[model samples]
Target: MMPVQVVGLGLDGAQGLSPVLQSLVASAKLLVGSDRHLAYFPDHPAERLSLSDFHSALAAIVRAAEAGVSPIVVLTSGDPLFFGFGRVLLSHLSPEQVAFHPQVSSMQLAFSRIKVPWQDARLVSVHGRSLEALTQALQQGAEKLAVLTDPTNSPGAIARLLTSLDLPWQYDLWVAESLGGEDERVQQWPLAAAQQTTFAPLNVVILLRQTQAPVLPTALPLLGIPDVYFASFADRPGLMTKREVRVLALGELALPADTIWDVGAGTGSVAIEMARLGPASQIYAIEKTAAGVALIEDNARRFATPQVRAIAGRAPEALEGLPDPDRVFIGGSGGQLQPILSVCRDRLRPGGRVVLALATLEHLAEVSAWSREQGWHQRCLQVQLARSTAIASLTRFTPLNPITLVTLTRSEPSPL
Candidate 1:
């Protein structure tokens, strides 16, 4: 079989082809491409085969090869292997039967125009897939993204989707249209503005996270955050879990939790942190006080974590209507530590962890007894954090109340 030569074309069209690539195209016995590509060579002597859709094009290419067509050429946009038809052709055929001449990918061009490095960025294509993948990446705290959009899933549609998810505040969007062409336009727009504006069908979207953005969406694991970063009630400045204690509790909860419950979630500090740690998971903040609920909502919004949902009402009762959790964090048990632990233990999936952070010995004794009764594995840690303060010209260490964290993991059933 003759080696099918796949040539990558940029927005510069046929004019952008190098001398070597131009000769290869001009000398082809048969050329296969879309009508737009075929239009580039009006006076060429090669027999033109215009086709749309991948399946039909593959079938046509097979027929041409069987017909003894020598020096077949396929025209594609940008780098044929960078989310292009050349990859499909190679998959249907063999590497030895195909040759690729790649141009600069649209993603590369878009990033270059914006004058930013994309080596650390996530690349995605919504050509035929759902926007959920993009949403997931954002929730996971991706700092940079380059998405290829199709006609139905235009830049405006994507913008609308982000705004609908209350994500407009986190990222800056840039739409690069018709690169390398006379009508080329590369413009940056706030996600809100992009939702209302329209762009050409052929475009790439670049999303960059804003500076000092609190939400940790990327793969860099965020363990602990200081108390100063969160909001607290006027009468309770130090009510929330300190960063040191939060980190220890998080380690016990494990990672990639499918479902998480933060019981007695005061101000949702622990809940928000859990959501950040496991962005792909769903986290529920169960709070009894109305003020606590309001604060949880505010903090979740501030972090731009849609996965953290604040539920107002007391638990083991509030936990009734919610989904079972793989990891549970009980920051305040409302003096019902035993009953709450029982409910959480019963609701936890096998191997799931339940972490309780308490300020007293009574709560600790109750949790330890419950763990032994349930035949579950348990671990205990105590955190005593103190911050240094300035008393006059000399530095003084201010002591914080000690906290105890009890971790219980539901043991797997014995083998049959």
Candidate 2:
């Protein structure tokens, strides 16, 4: 049996085909493609089958092949396997049973037409899928993105999504339509223009991060700001509280805190979050390192959470100056866990709570023992998180360090 040939075509139709591909198409005994795809080759003398339903199309292709059809060609747009129909074909047909002839993908053509290197660009298809991946990518501050869109997930929808993310960085959208065709359209559009204007049905959008500060979104995510948005200490890039751990830590904080003391606040991740949650509340971020104190200020400005006040000095000592706190989060103990808790025990106001994110068993053990000794009300949550990342050609979940959050509140004093 002849290997079923899957030929990829651009919007330029027959004009886009190479001499070799034209001959292959001309020689087919059975041709299969969408209505528009089949219309490209009017002169061909092949049994034509419209490819509407994959299951039904596969049945016809199989029947024709078993009956000794020669040169069976399946037409698709762009590199058929790249977010295209080739993957579906290969799913049912054995690798040996199908041969894929690919054109430059829409993603590829969009990048080239825009004159940018896409080697590092994150590519997502909303053609027939959800926008979850696109949302995640933008929130992560991906420097470049190439999106494949259908009528439903059009450029306008993408423009709306971009504006709604409330990102620290700004992005500009580039829309490319009917690529490789005589009537191809390519234009860079401000998000507003892109949203209001109608575009060619066949289009791809390139989202590029602008260098200037973003016009801050009116509705930024109060929680779950990606760690990338926070500027970290040059020396300790990975030391800051991760979003997963920070979020769990924040939950224990209890909302609408009057005053928050973030002890050993490295890069001020937790502190900034506290400020975001309660913009009117007082937030004092105490960090031992001078660099950490400065970074806290920088991130505070970026997030526009002015309530975050960075105090330079270690805890137990730094706790001396700040007013009594309603909520306290100890992200780093700096080898003074017990003494720090000593201060928290002494100063935490009535109805106050302290939350500790401990990375080591020794610290958890120390915190566990300390809470026991203090006779304070205690609650604990152990968090283990893994994030999916690309490795070579496949995705793998990279595990973050395990974190244990211990929440403590002083029990009402015994009646005198």
Candidate 3:
């Protein structure tokens, strides 16, 4: 009777095969794998069965076994049973008809290269699966992850998806490519930088969460982040939007926005909030002041919203070179309200929304006029919020600044 074996060969190629496995392969009447794997043993006398077509390869293997072709070896990469074809082969063939020899999996080698123990990591294969697997892993707080990636679901694609999730900034990403092979590459990158990088198609990705859990547990539905959660100018406590107003503005922004721009992003409170609310959105925080820029960066990193890109130039000028936004939040105009409004109106995508957090009536009047001139639908709400404060013997209600939230949306055309 023929003895079928699935030998795992990873990146080490022929050198990784053991002497016993080598002997078995040298004696086999049939061998199967991709062309690259077969190329490793050029002198072997076995009849080659390429894996380009699963049905053809399976038929050939079965026919060989039925004809009593001794020592039939099917070569594969890494651990054959893990996200590999060995599992499928076992389901089709009897245990007595097959045996498996597993080399170090690429996932194992990836973690070894990083010198991190990964017994607890969630092993996800994006080869033929949706990215929702990754989203579920992150949302469930799996701190350590090792992903098996394919050409389509590349490391860059995975990074962008993760960044788009608006997860707290807590992971250090490592890409391990061509493990155990010549020209193997292993590098680490921040999520933002990873989104802009290109990696070899064959790679393993390891994500190590910088911390055990989010510093502030994301309150369900992602709102009501306290003003003190962000880093702001100590003397300018009022610079941030009060939690109540921030939530209202977030509601008006009608989240799950594809793209958002947070103009005058003081301490990035509103921008960060928008990011958390709409994880799939690209949120840009544009601030003109050096201190504001620094604060936005610090807060974005602190909150794990690296997706919230902070620009250091004033609006209208800074807004240049940015993508058309699905939602624009103007919190500080730097007295360029009219010009900023004009640019926002021009850059806003069709059916997009613009929200302005105005402390002054002048800015409100300018925005309302612009909405009218542009023929966009407009709505305004004045948010008056008061929080409880404690004195020696009593709790008193302290009122915060009232903000006028102006929302403008372009009208969808009537049916012809």
> In each prediction, how many residue pairs overlap at the backbone (N, C-alpha, C within less than 3 A)?
4, 0, 3
The parts of candidate 3 lying over 4 Å away from their true place are: 212-416
Please give the lDDT score for candidate 2: 0.83
Better of 2 and 3 by TM-score: 2
Which segments of candidate 2 are over 4 A away from where they belong? 139-141, 163-170, 209-261, 264-294, 300-328, 331-369, 376-416
Cα-based TM-score, every candidate: 0.57, 0.67, 0.55
Error of 1 at 202 (Å): 1.1
lDDT against the true structure, per candidate, is 0.79, 0.83, 0.80
Candidate ranking under lDDT, highest first, comes to: 2, 3, 1
The digit string of per-residue lDDT tens for model 2 on 283-391 reads: 9999888888888888899898888999989778878878999989988888999999999898898989888988888998898899889899878898998866432
Report the C-alpha displacement of residue 57, candidate 2, in angstroms.
2.0
Per-residue accuracy of model 1 over 303-348 as CA lDDT, tens digit each: 7789999998888888898888888898987877778888886788
Whole-structure CA lDDT of model 1: 0.79
